[model samples]
Target: MDELVERVDAEDRVLGVVSRRDAVREGWLHRIGVVVCRDGQGRYLVHRRAEHLSRFPGHHELAVGGAVGVGESYEGAAARELSEEMGVRATVCLRFTFLNRSGLSPHWLAVCDALLPEAVAPDPREVAWHGWLTEPELRQALGQKTFTPDSREVFDRYLASRAAPATVRNRCP
Candidate 1:
């Protein structure tokens, strides 16, 4: 809660840096960078957040991420999160960026995807449990409230991005 995070407006421009606690308490939009790791087999890494986490504890997440630092880029944040959580360094591409208003906290979530290397060791403190899940399995897991709402929103957007024609995808609003 005391972590310093970048604060942004509804339009996703960085306003300044604020404590994570203040941002959530005041409903200020902040930046969160998420990394969705996919193995060579195309299964995504899904994890249960540690119960001790202040936000979205014990919830299923399609990505591993956290608030972006004051001076960090979205892509950098995503890569850092992947390294921290999975103990593997990998390049992550920014797939999309959108304002997430799900649940109580609103944030400008930048979703990134990474191809997992051969090594992966989930951090026990951050990830209580984790496994590779197919897209269908991921969809099925999202039915419960135990899944993070913003992540569900991300999944929806991900699906939309895949199904939408390239002509339409360029005009995301």
Candidate 2:
């Protein structure tokens, strides 16, 4: 499949056109997938990207992620990537959205969360390694540079949304 692409300004406004690969490579405009998985114990799953990935290779990230394809909804891309990368199925529940414009490739990120029954089988091609971590552990990982900038933002947002009393109550009930 052709990589998804977008045109945008310094402020991330639609401007012209470009290829998604170029956006990531050249730091243009693209979309990112942010998937959050929570286990029964309330811990979240995180993974390290494969060293072979073009960008931020070997960086820690959420359990599954990818670029949003052209004409594909963020939820769809998240679901597809989650299944492909982790061998875990889930219905993506959109939790946060952000537009990052300072990077070489600006991007609109759609972050989603889901619950899983157990640890997933990680595809070696996509994920180098993975583990379950609590919110504090994840924060420490961020401070230690274990997570990429994009993943850090997503993790922070996911934690904030999930920690809200209303959200937690609804999930447990």
lDDT (10s digit) by residue, model 1, range 1-173? 48899888878888988998899999999998998788898788888999998787898888888889889998899999888887889888777888888866888888887789645898899889888888888878788548887878888887776577866555432
The list of candidate 2 runs beyond 4 A from truth reads 6-18, 102-104, 163-173
TM values, all candidates? 0.89, 0.81
Alpha-carbon lDDT, every model: 0.83, 0.73
Q: What is the Å distance of residue 50 in model 2 from its true position? A: 1.4
Q: What's the residue-level lDDT of 143 in candidate 2?
A: 84
lDDT, candidate 2, equals 0.73
Candidate 2, residues 40-83, lDDT tens digits: the string is: 89888888889998777888876477777666677888889999
Question: Of the candidates shown, which would achieve the greatest TM-score relative to the real structure?
Answer: 1
Give the Å shift of residue 144 in candidate 2.
Answer: 2.6
